[model samples]
Target: MADPWSKKNPFLSMMLSGANAWAGIARGIMSGQAKGQQAAAARQGNKQVADFWTSALTGGTPKRPRTSKKRR
Candidate 1:
């Protein structure tokens, strides 16, 4: 006779395995989202620093300034 409490029951074993699988999938998704957000924040910070240095070196002047024609 097979014990009801044991993993001998196919239905009970399948249900338990399915629950564990779902939990693992959920954890993976959450972890991936967190990593993506961190990477995005790092990229934004690097871009800001680059912009600051460029402006400081260039004295905040436009690359091409418009010249108005002088009428006599």
Candidate 2:
């Protein structure tokens, strides 16, 4: 049987790539490197996720974000 953890396994490779991406994002956030636009973008993404779950569970509309201004 083929090894499930081998790099040739597409599913494992995809999962590893996602993990690497999350690690980079976490590192940036922890190191204070995700600044200004990056930080705002991250916050917005997180809010969207939270809103999605909240609305889904409560059967309510997702809350609007606090800011709509475009980041340069």
Candidate 3:
């Protein structure tokens, strides 16, 4: 006969193992996807910021400037 206090609870045992496994699987998938998304967003944001700076520094329609003479 099984001891009264040490008796196994079938419901908790069944749910615990599968739930723990599922939690690990979900965490891995979510974290992997989250990391990929974060990397993509960072690259896109950096490219956009770099493009803005490049245009700000170098992009303009070229034009001729007037000459000035110094009078001493």
Candidate 4:
């Protein structure tokens, strides 16, 4: 039996292929953003934990960071 729905039409086949490529690109972009967000959240959580430990070690007094003053 001959397949009537074969990809004989070049235009339709190209359109379908283009759509599939676009969908894959979109999925990759979304996954990348999600990974970035997860990384950011993990960094923030680690900072919070470090701050808590610093405070605990310093008897609840968080030390202020020293800044350089410009001489006039």
Return the top candidate by lDDT: 4
Off by over 4 Å in 2: 1-7, 33-72
| Model number with the top TM-score | 4
Give the CA lDDT, 0 to 100, for residue 14 in model 3. 89
Worst 10 residues of 2 by lDDT: 2-11
> Compared with the true structure, what per-residue lDDT tens digits does model 4 show for residues 1-72?
888886499898899999999999999999999999999999999999999999899889757998799779
Relative to the true structure, how large is the alpha-carbon lDDT of every model?
Answer: 0.92, 0.86, 0.92, 0.94
Q: For candidate 1, write residues 1-72 as lDDT tens digits.
A: 966665477887899999999999999999999999999999999999999999999898588876798779
Question: Model 3, 1-72: lDDT tens per residue?
Answer: 868879898998989999999999999999999999999999999999998898789875467897698778
Q: After superposition, how far is residue 7 of candidate 3 from its true place, in Å?
A: 2.9
Q: Count the backbone clashes (under 3 Å) in each candidate.
A: 0, 0, 0, 0
TM-score of 3: 0.64
Indicate the residue-level lDDT of 65 in model 2.
78
Candidates in order, TM-scores: namely 0.66, 0.36, 0.64, 0.71
| Over 4 Å off, model 1 | 1-12, 61-72
